[model samples]
Structures are given as C-alpha cells and as structure tokens.
Target: MTSTVRRAGAFAILSTLSLVVPLFDPVTAVPVAAAVLLAAFAVTDGPLFDLFAYPDDYEDGRLYGLITFVLAATALGLVSVMSSMSTAVFVGTVVLVGYGNLAAAVTREWTDNPASHAAAFCVGATTAGVAGHAISRTLTGDPVTDTFPKIVFLAVAGALLAALLRDILILYDDPVVMLAVGFLCWLLAELVPGLGATEIAVATVVTVAVGYLSYALGAASVAGMLTGILLGLLTIVLGGYSWFAVLMSFFAIGSLSTKFRYDEKVDRGVAQENDGARGSSNVLGNAAVALVAVLGYAASAADLPLLGEANPELFLFAFAGSLATAMSDTLSSEVGGVFDTPRLITTLEPVEPGTDGGVTWQGEVAGLLGASVVAGLTYAVFPDVGLVGAAIVVTAGFVGMTVDSLLGATIEGTAVGNQGVNFLATLSGAITGALLVLAVAVL
Candidate 1:
C-alpha cells in the first residue's frame, strides 16, 4: 500500500512539474518531462497501459525509453527553434507534438476498454486544442489569424477520433464509413459559422469523392484509401493543390506498376499481399517522411547553410525521392518475379525468385526505369527541379534500392518486418535526395 501511494504521489508531482516547467523553461522542460513520464509509466505501468509493463526487462525497457524520450525532446527543440518567429507555426508544432502523445496513448491496442481510449483521447485533444489556441493568441496578439491553430487541432483530433470509433463501432475497415466520418467532422466544423464554410465543404466533398474513386479503381485497399484521403487533406491544407497533385502522381505510378504482371505474379506466388492492393501501413511507410518534410517546409522557409533553403523544391525533392524508392521496390519485385531466375543480392548465388534478397537483371533494369519515370514526373510537376534535380532523384532512388536489398539480405526477414524495410528505404531515399539538393546549392 505504501509503495502504491508513493508511486501515485510521485506521478502527481511529476505531472505538475511537467506542466509548470514548460511554461518557464521550455527547452529543458520538454526532455525532462518526457523522461519523467516514461519513468512513471515504467514504475506504475500507467493507468491505461498496465499490460505494457515490462517487469522482466524493466531495466532494458527504461534505458530504451529514455533514449526515445531524448530523441523526441531533441526533435521538439529543433522544431521550436525553426518555428519561433511565426506564432501560428509555433503553436502548431507544440500542438502537433502533444497530438502525437495522444495518438500513442489512444492506439495502445493492449488496453482492454475502448471507452478508456476514447475518454483519454478526448481529454487530451481538448486540452491540446485549447492550449494551442491560447498560445497562438498570446503570441500574435491577433485573434483573427490565431484561429488557425484551433482549426488544425480540430482536424487532427477529429481524424483520430474517427479512426478509433471506426474500430470500435464498425469493427472493420471500410472506406465508406471512414469517409463518412471525415465528412461529418468537416461539416460540423464548418456549420459553427467560422471560416468560409462553403469553401471547406466543397473541398471536403471533392477530396472524399476522389478518395472513393481511387478505391473503386482498385488503386488501394479500403484502409489505404482512407489513409490516403486523410493524408492528402492534411497535406493540401498545409501546402497547396499542386503539392497534393505531385503526391497523387506517385500513387498513380506505383499502382500502375503493380498491375503490370499481376496474373503472372499471382501464379508465381510472389505477388503483393491482397492482390497488389496496398494498405494503411504501405501508404504510411512510403509517404510519412514526405509529409514530415512538407510540415517542415510549411513551418519555415529559412536557409540552412548546409541544406539550402527550405522551399517547395526541397519538399518536392523529398516527395519524389520517397515515391521513387517505393516505385523502384514495387517494380523490382513485381516485374522481377517474371524473370527466369534470380540471384541473392549479397552472395550472387542463384536463389528462388521470391527470396527476400533475391535480385535479377531484369528486375534491376525495371527498378531503374521506374525511378527514372518518377524523376521525369517530378521534373514536370515542380518547375523548380530541373534536369539536374531529375538526375538527383534517380540517384536517390538507386541508393534507396541498394539499402533495401542490403537490409533485406541481412536483417529484414530475421528481425524487421517488410513494412519496416520499406520505411527505411524510403527514409534513406528522402535523406539522399535532400542532401543532393543541398550539395548542388552549395557548389
């Protein structure tokens, strides 16, 4: 009983400190608070996350958790600094970070009760929404523009809530249900007499219609289609229609490639899961990093002496590179499966066609061809990317493909899942593309 009391008291104190310290000293408080919360979770197992307790590996878990906390803190600090000059961006960054925590909490599948998740998400979202609004107003001294933070919070929280309710109520993935939830949320937001309700309603309608059409076209699974819609909405809100169009082009290329040898692939037993239909995991793995780049670009257009200016060019480079990697990987696997034989990428020894690390000349050529197509698309879409930028995109794609093969040969099947491998490859491609842009600007 004493132990429980002590733990509870500690948590209360830490929670208070977390809230208070951030107000006075944000830089120090962010990481310290994260560590304290992680420690609290490890000690008491968290009220809603007891099943996640690691009694057997407490020390190891604590160490890893602390490391993650530190990394998160560092990232938050960077964002804070980058967005310091803009009140809207500053508020958005803080709220986005808080939203991440809410997401993590609510989506903890180990929790027994759906009600608990919903309650926690609602409370967290409300607090974050109110706090972001207040902060933006305080910083800008302009109530008019400050409303943006609240709207952003509303969209994000609504989307998350919709996802949670879909799982609990519908109990299955359905595009129609998800889109309905999204549309309803937007309608409610607009009905309250705020920013041009007609415009918001029209945009929402068009976006949802496009998403449904994509689903009917068989470009994505139900879950994938919904994910794409949500992601697209957010990106369009942050960037512009052109940016969203560039993003959709990637999907078009990737989906078309999956259909290239569809029947043969199924017969060879090497087809993508679900008849080449992508899911939410695939969408996120390929495009999440690009979305982050978009956010960064939205936050500031500052010039990093090393990375050049944060501009539309940089964002498109990241977008194209990641999509290029996804295209390369998909084309390689689907088209390469049609080859007579493949050799292990690492050993050069002949292996089964479907082996994780297997490669073929035909597949390699197809992968490059796919990457080049993305480069052309990127160059055409974003006028900022010239012929040199196209080359850079192709190079990044090739590099990512190599990384994918190396990881697959060494650890993909043994330790990491296929999704993880895909994410890593796309991440590498984004990094490589960004670096090339920086190099060119510097030179």
Candidate 2:
C-alpha cells in the first residue's frame, strides 16, 4: 500500500484507542503519552487525528510526536482531576473538543505543521470562551458566587480600561499575566500559602482601572499598576473596595512621575512566533495553580480549620508576602527597565536594565515603593497587623526579586537551568515574607 494510505491507517487507529489508554495508564503512561497515543492510534487504525496526517516521507516521525502529545495530555488531565473535580472535568472538556477537532482536522487531512497547531489553538480559544460562559453561569448559580460576578466584571473590565489608557498599553500581556498570576496565586495555596480568588479578581479589575486611568489620564510613566491591584485587594479585605481610591492612586502616581525612568514594554525575549499559543498554555498552567491558591484563600476567608484556623496571622502573612513579591517583581522590572544605569545587585555596579541580577537606584527605589504600596494596602485591610505584615512583605518581596534576578542571570537560559530553581525562588520569597511577619510578631 502507498505510504499515504499507511499513514492514514495509523491515524484512524489512534482515534479508536483513546479509551484503551486509561487501562495501561491507570497510574501513568509512557514518557510521551499524548504523542505516543496519537501515533499508536494512527498506526493501529489509519487516518490520523481523524483530521490530517504525515507527509509521505515523515509519517513515522509524525506518529511518534502525536502520540507523545496524547500521553502527556492524558497524564496532565488526570492530574488536574486529582486537584479539583471541577478542574479535571473542565480540562477534559477541552481535550474532548480538541480530540473532536483532531478528528475533523484529520479527516479534513490537516497536517501537524504550524497550520495544524494554529487550528488546534483556535479550537482551544473557542473552548475558553465557552468555559467563560459556563463560569458566568456558575457565578450566577442558584446561590450565585455571591461577590464573584461583581468581582469578575469589575476586575476584568477595570484592567481593560487601564491597558487602553496606557501610552504604550499592553492589554494582552498584563491581563494574561494577571490571569496567569491569579492562577499561580491559586497553586501557591498548595503550600498553604494563599491569596483569595475574590481578592485576585478584584485586584485584577482594580489594577486595570488604575492602569488605564493612569495612562488615559496621561499621568504616571509606569502607571503603578501593582499599586492599584493591592489597593483593590485591600478594599475587598475591608469588605469591598472603592473605585475612587483605585483611580486616585493610579492617577496620582502616573501624573506625578514626570521624569519617567523605566520603559514598561513587555520584553522582546517574551516575543515569539508561537507566543499566543504558548501564552495560552501558560494560562492553563496558571489556571491549575490558581485554583489551588484560591482554595487556600477560600479556606482562610471562610475561616476553615486546616488552612485558616491554624494561625490566622500566618495565613495573613502568606497573603501579604505573595502580594509583596508580586508588587516588588512588577515595580522592579518596570522601573529598572527605564533606568539610565542599572547595576549588578551583588556588586552595586552598573549593568543593563533587563539583565538578570542587575539593579539600579531607580529600580531599587521602585521595588521598595512597590512593597510599601502593598504593605500600606495590607494595613488598610487589617489594620491591627497591616504594618507588620507589609514590612514583612516588603523585605521578602525585595529579597525574592533579588533571588529571581540571580536565578535568571545564573541559569534561566544557561547550562545550569532547572525548573527546581524557579520553585525555589517562589519559596524563598514566601519564606522571607513569612519569617519577617513572624519575627516582628514575636517582638
């Protein structure tokens, strides 16, 4: 038979074996399950993905790649379910949609080239929109999410405005970042370190409003978005945030910072041909991690035993620390970028603005100020411990920033690179924040 026929035959088999995978993979599949599954399906059945197939010369190799993807996805999906029943189902739905498209794209004879990847992404994007609609419904459930709808609407809408207002607004990255960080905030909850979804959503909306108003109003150079997010979160802690403060803070800072030091552009490094799709994947990672973080937050917010009840102060400290870290990171990156002479953090000598471990007077000050902003907001939320918490967060955040810089400079794109280091950066930041809060409270 022709190679085309053979390739088509393999693809068809992959679609059929979709269910059979779970049996062998009841615990875990082979190294590259997704690609393996696809390849297996194709080789055994014929007609890949039921949508497209390999070039006559590259059929075998394509099958290998496709199977690896399937196996990985299955493993990922299962793990997601272990975390949250709802999340698992949600991810599963996405897989189902993707598979259906895989089928169509296959029968339609789509290849696993850039075009196919894009087609897959389109399917995923559509799935996200649908998921949002579902979330809208969930938010408005019989009992509703209570404060959620207002929070989501306010946060998402607010951020959009901020992006639009900026002289050089980056709507995609900021929102995507918030969306990503919000999710990361969720995952951090697994550490029993937490930030609430309500607060995050509110922070998001408020940040947007603040950023946009700052920009549209032509006020601050950097817009001080982190200032707005913390402020918004603080308002929520006080039961609800007022828009007036958000707008005022962003505007005041935006307008006041006339000298303008840092360039607030998303780094060129972040730019890639497949950035949109990669960004989308990162968002997925965010979703998983964020949900966990949200769980930790909800536990605390609701005064639950394991997370919140253990030590309210500790939980509070965690939240403060995370916020401070985020703020410091943002401010440092933003302000530092604009500095005329950034320097090495360790040496205190001049270096490039975007260089990891590099620091500048402008950036350091920005970092300090950023931590202070979050700390101030923390005070506004729970006045009794606000100052202490903020101080802890500030110290921790700056340290985290320094560590992140070190990690980036030393290993991020280099030979010593490791994912473990990234986690360590986060842990050190949280620990720094937590320790500081505890130390002061002891006094």
Judging by lDDT against the true structure, name the best candidate.
Answer: 1
Q: Rate the local accuracy (lDDT) of all candidates.
A: 0.61, 0.43
Provide TM-scores for the models. Answer: 0.60, 0.48
lDDT of 1 by residue, 1-443 (tens): 33323332332232233233234445655666566556644554344233222233254444332233334434544444454322333343334334423443444544655434443444454455445545555544556453654364454545444544444443222223223433433333332223454444455555666666777787776667666776676566556676677677667777887888788878878877787777778888878877776665654443334345546566668777887887788788778887878988999999887888889999889889978988887788778788999999999988888788878888997899888998999889988998899899999
* Model 1 CA deviation exceeding 4 Å by range: 1-157, 164-203, 302-312
The 10-residue segment of model 1 with minimum total lDDT is 7-16
